[model samples]
Target: MYLSDKVLIVEGKTDKRRIEEVLVEPVQIICTFGTMGVSKLDEILEQLDGSEIYILSDADKEGRKIRKWFKKHLSESTHIYIDPKFGEVGRCPRDYLANLLMRHGFYVDTSLIMKGKFYDERAVGDTGYIQSYSL
Candidate 1:
């Protein structure tokens, strides 16, 4: 998780927060905020110098365009391909992201020890607790 030399370029804040949640150590994360503006060019390039770059874009058309840009700019970098079938980057599960990060040599544990916001047996049949998944 802690990659001082490597940095992750994400699409939005939610994706950043999701990755941060599962990471065991601090890794530099950059959210492009839909599109990369001119001002961000220098900042991104700074990280690119002597550092490995990983792009984590959404599954949408806009995301693809950005991916193309990164590929054109930094072809040597690796990209974390998010399956469109699962939805966009923000909707991806923490475990999946963690697994993907692991492939890039990041130390992340996807198995969350804390129940967190997940529905428990007690929450079943409760009107307020909308069941999002089945065990």
Candidate 2:
């Protein structure tokens, strides 16, 4: 299988699908399925060798647990957060997701960014605290 140099670790298939929709560039997104077994992690680690990794987990208890796990196993991975109000990546608006990925240096579908401009602001509730990711 082909793997892009950029890898984004998410919580589940839904999260993967959500990200795939807005990403314009190639990024190998892998799902942890809400948790990971040691063997699964080892296999993922082997596949991720020398790749630039990013973790975009949900902002909740289970997601926090997954983030902690990645922190232990993949210390070099960058972390991306969705506002707590959204709680999960799959529920986050497409425009918001596009902009967030773009700010992290990932190329996103410009149409999605423009579409986000027309999205109802109350949905995301003034999310000015977007964290920056540096390469």
Best by lDDT: 2
lDDT of 1 by residue, 106-127 (tens): 6565354224433133422366
Report per-prediction Cα RMSD to one decimal. 10.1, 6.9
Instruction: Tell me the tens digit of each residue's lDDT in model 2 across 41-74.
Output: 9978987869889999999999998888889988
TM-score of each: 0.74, 0.80
The TM-score obtained by model 2 is: 0.80
User: What lDDT would candidate 1 get against the real structure?
Assistant: 0.71
What are the runs in model 2 whose C-alpha is more than 4 Å off?
A: 1-3, 115-135
lDDT of 1 at 14: 91
Poorest lDDT segment (10 consecutive residues) of candidate 1 = 113-122
